[model samples]
Target: MATTTGTEAPELTGLPLLGSLFDLKNDSLGTFLRARRDHGDVVRISAGPPGIRTTVYGVFSAAGAQQVLAGESANFRKDNAFYQEVRESFGNGLLTSQDEDYLRQRRLVQPLFTRRRVDGYAAAVAAETTTLIEEWRDAGAGTVDVLQAMTRLSLRAVARILFGTDVDAAVEIVEDNFPDVGAYVLRRGYSPLNVPRDWPTPGNRRAATVHRALYEVCDRIIAERRSSGGAPGDGQDLLTLLVEAESAEDGSFDATELREQVLVFLLAGHETTATSLGFALHLLALHPEERKRAHEEVDRVLAGRTPGAGDLDALPYVTRVLKEAMRLFPAAPVIGRRAVEATVVGGVAIPAGADVIVAPWVTHRHPDYWEDAERFDPDRFTPEAEAARPRYAWFPFGGGPRACIGQHFSMLESVIALAMILQRHDLEAVDTVVPVAPAITLQAAGPARCRLTPRRP
Candidate 1:
């Protein structure tokens, strides 16, 4: 018995044949917003021949997001084209894993990110960020690319706390190949043709080479740790925890699964954290009053010392700034899921094979959920204001069972890094033009450059 999908969905008409392909590729944010503005919560944007029916249903409202993310998540699993595409470089890691296997892996990794473990990671985050600020001091008033600075700082933090290794070496490998993989993915995603990764095409070949190198990086790190009799940080960090704590053969991650977990941590943790912090610092750079307020809060909370994990609650304004920045520039702006069964989101009939997109950027800034939707106002996240909005309105870390495992870890890392930077320096925006580049992660398409000025003592 087929359940009839309720309410007719308004469709966004596009050019013949190409449909909305070019529009989505060139101006995804604009295209998504336009669909919402014109068609209400459930907007259908097709991308195929005139009547061929290869359509994508965009969920634009917070309630629509709730339908896909929380309301009926069981019917709409992560078995989608986006996950298939991401699995090319990183393999079937937790980022792309599903159902039973995913649950097993999640349970094994859950203990590694508990509050106690995350609190333990604070010292490494503070030390790495303080070192990064010191390097800016050594440069003596030189202009810096905030994104690059943040990438290195974040990668190092993950390496030391999670991998328990000398971060400089891993940082070099991560920096070299991550951008290559990301750019290749973005190009492939936007390309009209659907080329498989196994094909011998030049782009596929290049991506393969990069993924191989990335896998090798993971292999070497794991091999070294195992060869050392698995004495990883004396069994303190996640690497050691994963290796030593074997709940069951069916309950734990094996060698291959462990490698995928590392890649997930490295990319998901390192890239998203860097991107979010980059935007946070950039927002602070543009809004001096907010930055000054953040500084005051940090000063009051830390009292001239580095921010520890314990002080996360004390720095309410700093947390709000992060919350606002993520709302504006969500690291993973859009999350995709393919419906395993026929479903309706916001009263639109979604056939079984349809790809459903829940764009946080659109939902977060929806006029219905947000005031002055485009403005950078951290106060929108204050207790009273946030409590009034729909819970799904601002899910930077996503929602439901498949939410980012490192959400807590990322928050702690970002707050510590941002506060530490504010304690030592102030970022002044230099690049006036920051384009939005939709890729594996959303980042400043242009150079996220800023003037690094030391704070006056």
Candidate 2:
């Protein structure tokens, strides 16, 4: 097996406990980027304990990433240490599962998120965004946090399309529980022995309660759908598909598996889209000229009406802005895999059992790959511009066999959301500071306060 001998391994010099502890508590992407810049793309660090080596692979090139994701994937497995913490909240959902279980779950859930099915939800996305915009207008922008607003709008859209019923109440349940679950999963030294739910620790208790509440919500939704007898005529929501989906072997997902899948879509699908939209809006507000270009594109194609799925192709500029926003702050910023066996990535030997971190945050901003990597230039994603670049250099939804199943869903949702919003009101950033926070998803550190004004004729 390929191995990095003591002499061949990247030099490691940081104080083990201090660096590891600080990295665990602070921005992981920032820490990893700094090390990569200082020590080159392939850097090894001792993460606080013996035998626990962290390998950050700088995938600045498409070929390098393909090597890890496609060429030598068999040697890599989902990082169980990281995912075990997530399993506490997400269970063995597709996002956290590994091996055969993961493959099975992904196969069963893939059909529901197929491009054809996801496209059908465009109307729902536009309607939801329109409703929220009208409400925001009626309220007369004192100071609205667009992040929270987008979260609500995106959640409602997911609810309408995924469940076929407006489950706004359940959306509220999810919003409340999501942060605590994310915090619990991200905490360092996380283990079953650390703290029990009954302990006095606020975080522990909150985690337990949130987990219970999430299950209850999922149970209610499942029971309601089952009683309703599949989809109502003409109802093409995701839950309808899930209720009817059959496996290749003539089996269907059991209640437990169904619950997990539903929860996964409910959480992963909506949250990431909302975060991307929030960031897009913020960027549009900051760059008035770019925002004007987007508005002009929307005005021409949409012609002052709501956008449908067909409008997606015509609104290329709007889509570019969203793509660039995700490139800058990918919702799933960093993805890692533990080497099940020794492997070679980009011609570099990766030892067995090493954690291989592939950070889109670093890759997206790599000076070697993108021109003006730090700037917000949506034009970079235009057809002509995109062709000039390598494929794997930009993977907000990841790639390979495990690429995000809901990518088309997100793109459709963002296109509709952006087009609908631009058609109505023009937004401006408030003086308030918008911090960048990396949670289960990268979100505006705090509320994203913005000023909204109705566009004049």
Candidate 3:
């Protein structure tokens, strides 16, 4: 490990407990950005009862993130406190599991998320988006929560693509479970052990019950699919693939593992993508010029037709809007890791067992790395401009071996959904400041109110 030649350990100047807890409860990115500005790129944060130290690095530069994510194994481990929280809900699924178990599950599940298989779901995505847009069109000039709509649309897409059935009955169950699971996983102040399921406390019982119900739903889906011989014939749904995948050493996922994988995809895949789409639409609504540009692109490529897998490459501006939105409010904003052994990050010595946090929300908007970092500029993600950025600078899906396996699927779904919606309707944001809150994924605090008007012919 490289040692810093400086005389004293760098200390962040603030009310450590209050600031840290406030950030934990509220907007973590804002807190981190303010702290980073005040206390340089690498400052020790003293938070929690145990006084854990966190190193917040700039998102514009990828060196520190690369070191922790893709560097040698001796330096880092996926053993963060948050991972324990995720395991509470997702069990040993790919998102939380580490080492060999993670590798095995990822390998088995990876083949299902291959480019070819994901592309196959494009038609289903467009169809679902069309259904959603039809409903929005019927309710013209009325206040609608685009965030909630996106959540429903994306959840339905995941359901249809993963299970090969509409399964609209499970939608309410999954939607109710989301906030509870999110609070339980992302918020650290809450304790799973102490809080009883029947407790009157705000999110404790709700989280517990929702988690059980979600697992039950997954269990039922798996059993139904397996007994039915994997969704008829020639189906490319994820459940079908899971029931059929084989491992060289351990064989295919057992019932429990299958259940966990389903839960992970249901929660991680849909919710994050929905949140990103919601934010993208919100950004476009706020910026009419960009909205007009996106509408023009949608009209040109899609030509009033619903977008399919083939239309994705042609909708570059729409892709840029989604990219910029994710840059500002990344679905999985802050990724955490624990140092398994002493290591050096950006010339600073990090002791073993230290907590490391890499925030794409912060990094993507770093002033040093981006021009007018705070402003919403989709052009920054254009082909020519994006080529100039560092490889790891703008990783909303993350990077390295443990990166999100469903990135391509999520991106494709977002583009198709956005294009379909744009084809039929124009969205305008209500003149209100919607706060972004983190609960496993970033979401609008209240409903993201917008008015949808049918597009003129």
Candidate 4:
């Protein structure tokens, strides 16, 4: 049993019956920010009406975030409604598994993401980036929707890395269908009430179609790979590695489990990295000085050559710029979990079985930890400055055992892509203001368009 303060956290006020339903649906990011601004670190926010009104305990402070995500993580289970929806859509992979299942999956998957192994994928990342750069140049120096471009770039890159020889068969299906799948996940994940997925509603039907297509492609690729009789760990790509992963006690993931893991990889691998790179470029476009600084670093580090794993440490300023962008627009803005038992967080008592969320969108900008919180300054990530803040203050990749497994892969991909792009062209924001909304991931609510000028010729 856990001790509590016996007092509940302050609640965000809402309308009659509907509570904060409309407010959340309209602008969830703003609502979370306001909750922390007006109601303090820990606030109770409710949505929907009486019976189905879903209220979550919003832990907004870095310390509170740490408590929920790290310190007392065992008490916060991923059995929340949002995760349930994710599991249904994505499958019971590492992202949605609980307890022993998650641990076993983690053990099997960990070897593939090791620093040395992940770094080996740099050549693949560089190759895809080169292709994107060529495409942009061929299109001429005009306004480009970076978010869209990066989304495609990341999907293709990950698909290539995952599918290898079968990249052609997998890339198009993932790129075309993921948006619908993500939209469906967001639609149901936050809803206080959802009809059964088999109900054949328009949303359900579309989601089912996309989900099936995505799964079939992955299954097909996996079958082909297995039929090829190539050893799992012996292959160059990630899917081969996943297929080869084995444990003494737990054995290996079966075919269905393989599809589930592939779905998760495709979702997290492309979407989050795309969000970071898109915003990093957009932010650079808006701030001339920062962009110039980044360009200088890129030029100095790569010296008119393609970026590789070795260049990551050499490009500190560019890395910081990406860090700042992630700080401002974390891909996974809000992470949810359910309190398994009564507990106290930041002096507020949360009852057992309560829905809980740790919002990086809010914690990254916590006034106490971040001065001039809304400003974009890469210097904030300098080692000395980062050490000055609490650990959880800027968790764009999340924290704890459940933290994103693709963290290193994402950073590596973002750094290489950003460096390569900056080396070729200078950017200007066509859509100066990139408003964001919380979907399955943090998405620019409108077009994140930018104009690029060739550095030479």
Candidate number with greatest TM-score: 4
Query: How high a TM-score does candidate 2 get?
Result: 0.92
The alpha-carbon lDDT assigned to residue 104 of candidate 1 equals 79
Q: Determine which window of 10 residues in candidate 2 has minimal summed lDDT.
A: 188-197
Candidate 1, residues 252-323, lDDT tens digits: the string is: 666787788888888898889988898898888888899899988888888888778999999999999999
> In model 3, which runs have C-alpha deviations exceeding 4 angstroms?
1-9, 16-19, 23-26, 48-60, 188-206, 232-234
Stretches of candidate 2 above 4 Å error? 1-7, 49-61, 188-202, 231-233, 248-250, 431-433
Q: What is each predicted model's overall lDDT from 0 to 1?
A: 0.82, 0.75, 0.77, 0.90
- Would you list the clashing residue pairs of candidate 4? none
Q: Tell me the tens digit of each residue's lDDT in model 3 across 1-457.
A: 5343532336555453543644544556677777667765565655443344334333224767776677644356667666777887788898878878988898888888889889999988888887877776665547778888898999999988878873575677788777777777766423323443367787766676787898888888788888888775566688889999997776889999998888888888788999889988888988999999999989987777767788889999999999998988799877777777666666666676777777787778776678888789999998888888877678888778888899999999999888887877787899446777666777777878888878852
| Regions of model 1 farther than 4 Å from truth | 1-3, 49-53, 189-192, 231-233
Per-candidate Cα RMSD to the true structure, in Å, reads 1.9, 2.7, 2.9, 1.6
Pairwise TM-score winner, candidates 1 and 2: 1
Model 2, global lDDT: 0.75
Query: Where does the lowest 10-residue lDDT sum fall in candidate 3?
Result: 51-60
lDDT, candidate 3, at 216 = 84
* Candidate no. 4 TM-score: 0.97
lDDT of 4 at 285: 95
Give the per-residue lDDT digits (tens) of candidate 4, residues 221-309: 89888888653454778888888888898899999999999999988999899999999999999999999899988887788989899
The residue-by-residue lDDT of candidate 2 on 1-457, one tens digit each, is 5444433446435664543545644656677677667766666655445444444444435666666666666666777566666765677888878788887777777777777777888888888888897887788765677788888888888877877764675787888887777777766323313555467787777677888998888777777777887755675777768877787653677778778887888878888999889889888988899999998998888778778888889988999999999998799887777777766665466677777767788888877778888898998897887888777788888788778889999999988998888887687887445767566677666777777778842
